[model samples]
Target: MGALARHWTRIAVTLIPLLIALLHASGALPLAALDRLDNVLYDARLRATMPRTMDERIVIVDIDEKSLAEVGRWPWGRNRMAELTDELFDRQQVALAGFDVVFAEPDDSSGLKRLRALAQGELKDAPGFAGRIDQLAGSLDYDAVFARSLQKKPAVLGYYFSSDRGGGTSGVLTEPVMKREDLRGRPIRFTAWNGYGSNIEPIAKAAPMAGFFNPIIDVDGVVRAVPLLAEYGDQYYESLSLAMFRMLVGLPTVEPGFPRDRFLGRGYQGLESVVLRLGQKTMGIPVDDRVSALVPFRGPGGVSGGSFRYVSAGDLVARRLPPGSLKGKIVLVGTTAPGLQDLRSTPMSETYPGVETHANMISGLLDNRLAVRPDYAIGYDVVVLLLAGLVLAFALPLLTAPKAVAVSLGVLAAVVGLNLWLFLGAGLVMPLAAALSMVLTAFALNMSYGYFIESRSKRELANLFGTYVPPELVDEMVKDPDSYSMTATNKELTVMFCDMRGFTKMSEKMEPVQLQELLNAVFNRLTDIIRDNRGTIDKYMGDCVMAFWGAPVETSEHAHLAVKSSMEMADAVRKINEEHREKGLPEIGVGIGLNTGMMCVGDMGSQVRRSYTVIGDAVNLGSRLEGLSKAYGVDIVVSESTRQLAKDFAWQELDRVRVKGKEQAVAIFWPVAPADRLEKPQQDELKTWAALLKAYRAQDWDNCEVLLLNLQRMNPKKFLYELYNERVASMKLLPFDPAWDGATNFETK
Candidate 1:
């Protein structure tokens, strides 16, 4: 065992790097997948434990449906927006007001004609397109009113960056927040164009300090991080959220740190921190000098009501709101109507309000509640990955299968738990994906190579049983053949038996050589179907095949798989018949029966002719069911035990019968195709049949008979209807047993 362990260890060590490389190359094991998994786990954890809202301060001004209906249509006149701004600064006494909506054009609702007429006075009455001229003049003058509102308070105008060439159509931007000279010899690159802002002259002049509100959404469209500053041409611009945060904290001038000489070359110092110099005190603001910050979203939908403070423009204009509500809050004016295109898709909500995101960010900054990935995070990830790989490589090879699995799972859980703890407790966002990758790589390498190393043993077992059992089962048995050595032990297992209907007459007409080829092909197809469903083929006798589940390997879904495979096999025979007809060969049909019960399974038969098979009353019933298939004129028959495991498929209870040698009656069902595939009438008929079965099982003879009659009228070929008819006839002649269970028992094997 020690020698074996050492060999396994050596293989594990050699395979880890290769597995990592393969997973990376295939793109199957993506960092993004881990990120998604992390998000899912986090969401579930949040749901279960109800993560307390961290100290992060976030407030929402919701532009909800109520606000939209009352405020009129979206893109309300700029004059009304200006009023909202005035209320925030004067009434709410908000530290800063940031516009998530852009004001690229003047608000024409203030009566451009009136402004022009006022400016021109007597000339406004002049003839010849005077109204048109007044309109243009009024529009130009209204720009000034909007700008004046912005000047009354510190406000950050939100704008977006466009990667498209057409972005230039939006016009030029204001002076940048950062200059090219400031970056020096950094490796930063910029290729986006600034676009789509309400650039009305009045608004621009009023709010000189603004930020781009373009969030850096990942490919999955989740906003996890925000760029603090971005370079456009030779200038750097701050994000709107960041700018608002800066203003709220008091607009302190920032001084660039001096350059420092490093081993690689001359590098700039203080790239990760900016000094905010205020009056007599200076505070260091931690940032990734490259101008990005990790956004600490407050759970899903952001701190419960953080989506917005929904208020209608109509309500404000009507003075319906209570006093002091908007007196001191930084209110954002934006839309939540889906048609407005201001909504964003998020894991938490399909129609996420975009403007509220800025509120959350600003609120978070003010509360000094921020989550960050330290500068050394990438290095930390690399270290974790390497260490995890090494640990798995050393430990997996020395432990048994169960122990190995336990250790792997434990390590995985530990890494994820620790990473989440860091995120929640320490405000640190660690790279969980990289750590998980290490664990996955280790497992894949060990399992992949273990199969290769154990091929000789597997092949020997396969050679011994492949002729009888399915190839998949043979491989499973080879994993630990000794444990499955011939024995008689009771264990719940699903058994299936399939036999060709009317084979004797069909075979007599065909040549011996053709018959052999046809039977081989049919059985081969059946074997493939069973293996595909993870069922173990027990043996084949002449035209009959026997397979079982929960032996050689154990699974909770064995009964489900057995029944599903039975249905699939029946479908396979139909397809086979179509091919046989095209090829001018004898057509064949199949009957399948599945039973789930405690049975003795092991390698049975003499040592000279050993074979693995199961035996018990359960196995006998399965064979009896195969014969009953012909009697009922149905392709597949399943006992109650099998039906219990079928969670997905629909079925019809065919009968309650005591076949040949069984004392107790059994309930049998025929698995039906999906409801979508069945015609409307067929679906109705099946419903009726099910109702009849229920009534019959309850000994409600009159209702059962009525339902069965309706079922027969709807679909005459339904075997279940005929079976119920027989049962109803017998109930009239003999007194029913009150203790009679709905169980169907088969007396023939």
Candidate 2:
């Protein structure tokens, strides 16, 4: 009981997320957000698993922009429709031609009926008008012409069902594929509609067959599937794709495919498939719980997919296409013109052509490749989620961080791999969002619990050490707290001191709050760069900042990171200045100094309050280098130790100087650029400077002066050359000492 009391917190932590995930999977707590996310996941899976090869069996006769331009506008007099139809069968010899457009209104663009009326009422006595009108009647009767053309062909007309309850419908609807009596006692659910818009009576009677082109839109406004059979006023009608498939298969009889278990006391035998019977041969077409088949998008979308050939409607009417180009192909006449508004959002694309959607469905149905979400999809989701969730929940508490991460990643990969396998291998598309979300959410919850609850010491350590060290280094220190302490210790590390130039002058013109804001913004950028490069910030003093690297987290590349941070900080100042210039404020500049040596670092101060900081002669030298930056007229000055350790950067020797309170002379250098970015011209300039420095050390004033002049000419605005020229002139006026090392000594810092 004592052990149970101790472990109760951990058990609760593990079970909480599992219970939430289980509830989600069992549909007891449905998330609309997750359902929407599931749609996106399904779309991604469909795109990845589709067979994107072109289907030569189907072709789209598009009333595209070109067709609209060349052949006037849409509903182009029925005579033109008759000409296109005749050209498809008579010239191209298509096997099956279907219209994706409905002839709901009569085409009167020919004006033949008006002409007849005018001839009888107003032009009866006019010179030869009646005789001429009678001669042109048969040619100009465009509706009759279009009807006669569709009379004997294997042409199927298209219409749409109105799901809107208040929408009134017109035109003549054909007979339903199955009657209400056929599915009387069957426990099947079909999508029902209130009204429909069918073809005009003359065109409807003329076409060999007809079907509705209505698509079922999901909650997210994406059309992923089409209902194979829909109900309207107790009659079941077929979709365009189903009708086309049926006609091709000798007009098979439609029947429900119910499992045998349904007869043996099954509660609700889910409608699995729609069985098509032609003689003794039967084929089962799978449908989802909503009685819709998932659309098998062959490729990205539209003409680019190449799933079907697209021939312009104008091209067919004008007979511009090659002979037999559409031969034996099942042609669908539709429009891709934006004005026609036949576009729909689908899984393949946001603006997919509705016509090819049907074509893809037809092709998928014939090939038996339509991915279906079976009735047991929710059960599969629940089982996977519960099992995987429980595994992670129980296992994560006993494992370390790295092992926990590996286990969680392995479970996620397994879930994704299995879902994809089912989709690609068995043509089964199950819900993956629930399983994936459960795994990810559970993993996150478990990790959160471990970090915030079980590992309180790590958090406390971070809170204590985060201000002095970077977050990453603090994390490293937390791993072994016994090895880290507030007691001072001597360690070899690199320290940096950075101060803004002319900040006092800039502040004189600004309000206190404005100056504070500017300082805060600049420091934020500099501090972020320092931390990003693995340097620990020690403290901020006035407009200056002091930071060090290689203490909390010992790294051999401490000098390299310190030097790199210095260079990036200088660049960051320039960017800030650019912003200042755009804002009509004074531009500011910063100077940085870096030194590498052994220093004492720990929490140190008076007994009243203490803080983590570094102290020693090496730290003082870093501050002295920052002060010398203004004297040298350069942005950055690093000690000789830093220059040697940071060999991967391009450096220019500034001077050999013995700073205040130091007798030993140390060489200082300015970081020019990174090694990879240094150009050949800069290398040549460095060589010239080296020769100049050598001559100066040798007390050869003439050659040193000449080199300074040449360097000044190369970079007219460079102050280093001028500073060196002045130093050489000053030294020439004084008596030369042969024992002198020619090191400039600064008496003040």
Candidate 3:
């Protein structure tokens, strides 16, 4: 229960954005940016899924520049419009035609009205003028001529819905697709308009069907959908595309398609689709909440696109079209000329002919392949968001950073892939913007916590072990803090002790501050050398310093590091002396001792103050070795155990002596140059010295003396050889014992 509670808490923190996105999807809260992003995704889906090939069933009768030139510009006389219509049906045998333009006023370009007035006034008495004018009146009435051509023809007239402009209704509107009485008891909201522009009364009466061509332009001015049904004064009207499709299928009646749950519950009254019913055949046309159907573009764009064939309007009017060219096809009359301003921004094209939009919609409806955002879209988004968020929130805390990143990436890919699959396979327009945003946002939040909080944890661990471990080892310790600590543990390690020689006498001669400064300078240089070789400083006891390795973090080369630090420390003292000599101060020297063995290492001391240090017999022997360095006339002396571990360094046997406090004998060696850099003379000298030790250990006094004399002559300044010679002389005075061994026992520390 506690784990679940903790998981829930973390999930809640990261799920804040998911909650907001859910609310936005549910319409409880609206986000403009998300809405715009959804539109962009919708556009991309349309472009990706479009057929991008010529439909060949629908053709555009375009009023191009060539058409305008041949027909003498736009607003051509109605007599010319009659000729175009007559030529299409009579000569081209087009099955159906729809206009993307409207004529709101009568065309009197034939001068018939003026001639009638002249007949009634000035030309009333002209010879045979009244009779001739009456005879030609019928032919001169261009509005009547156009209306006669459209009478009883399978032609749908187009119009526009005017909104935000007050009190402007032009021409005459056709019979509404559905009357207010048709849906008297049903609850439905249609897109309403204040006024409209329609064809003149004569044209409206003569056309077989009429529908508006006004599209539902989004806030970004991109036409993504068209209202299949619009309302004016509680009367629903059909769109041009919807009207053409209905006429094709024997004029099916339009009805609202609302979804219900449990057959009895009016759970959601929102419109889901627009249904067309002809006898028993039913077709459901998907619509959005606003009763608009998504525009199904067949290709890339309207004009340049190859979705529909375009024929110049002037060709039709001039009878230049081949017989049956538009036969058995749906013809839409529109213009692509830039001056006509029929171009619109659509999902498929920025500058598209308005007529092609209707063609695409008609094709989509006939094929029933329109992409629909189902009513359960919001529910799906919420479910996906919560599932992804919960999984990330719970799993991120338990896994390491790398594993958490892997899981997040997997979830992200699954989410995106599923969305695209639904879009392509099911023709379902699901909401991806919210789901994708939630996934990325949650992953970012999880990773940010690890980066910031773990960084602070690394700092804390560094502070805890910084003084007792190298910086590099401290970093390793922080990587797994639970397994590392300051508690004492017994482990085989190497410890080193270094002290300045003659420091007491030097301090007695100098002032207190001067002595302190000199000690600080010497200790700083020595400590830097120790750290450089991966040694940890244990403490600074006045002029002496203690350090160790293979603690807090394990290393296999602890002895090697200690010996290396010791050698570097000896060389560093020489550099310090050079600096002191340049400054007219007394030069200083140091003695270093290294020993390797099992020891208890960790924080040790009183409660008032404690320190991370080592304690055991090995640690005591290391101190004894440092004190023995002076007696051997050398800078560094290491125990046999340390010497065995550090085989890469050159060594010279110092003595076989047991320091005070212990009776067991142990061998000590002085570290020389690195083995790789040792000179041949030094190698030869070591070989001769080894033979001398063997002779001395065997009680052969004469051979030992002779070997020592030769070594002294070869390396005259070697005080260690003189000490061994003195030992040989002292042993010669004592009577030889058969059980005696060459082990010198020191009685002082």
For model 3, the superposed segments whose C-alpha errors exceed 4 Å read 5-8, 11-22, 64-87, 105-145, 184-187, 262-266, 303-306, 310-322, 379-422, 439-463, 466-479, 494-548, 557-597, 615-749
Superior candidate under TM-score, 1 versus 3: 3
**Is 1 or 3 the stronger prediction by lDDT?**
3
> What TM-score do all the candidates reach, one by one?
0.56, 0.64, 0.73
lDDT of candidates 1 onward, in order: 0.68, 0.86, 0.86
In candidate 2, the residue pairs with backbone N, CA or C atoms under 3 Å apart (3 or more residues apart, or in different chains) clash, namely none
Ten residues in a row with the worst lDDT in model 2?
259-268
Model 1 ranges with Cα > 4 A deviation: 1-14, 17-72, 91-93, 110-141, 166-175, 189-198, 255-275, 279-290, 302-308, 451-455, 458-749
Considering every candidate listed, which one attains the maximal TM-score? 3
Candidate 3: worst-modelled 10 consecutive residues by lDDT = 260-269
Angstrom error of the Cα, residue 436, model 2: value is: 1.2
State the lDDT at 436 in candidate 1: 69
lDDT of 2 at 553: 77
Instruction: After superposing candidate 2 on the true structure, give the runs of residues whose Cα lies further than 4 Å from its correct spot.
Output: 1-8, 115-139, 165-167, 184-189, 259-269, 459-477, 480-749
Report the C-alpha lDDT of model 3 over 344-413, residue by residue, as the tens digit: 9988778988888898898888888787776667677777777877777677766777898899899888
Tens digits of lDDT, candidate 1, 135-187 = 56543555565666778577777777766566553533655756777656565
lDDT of 2: 0.86
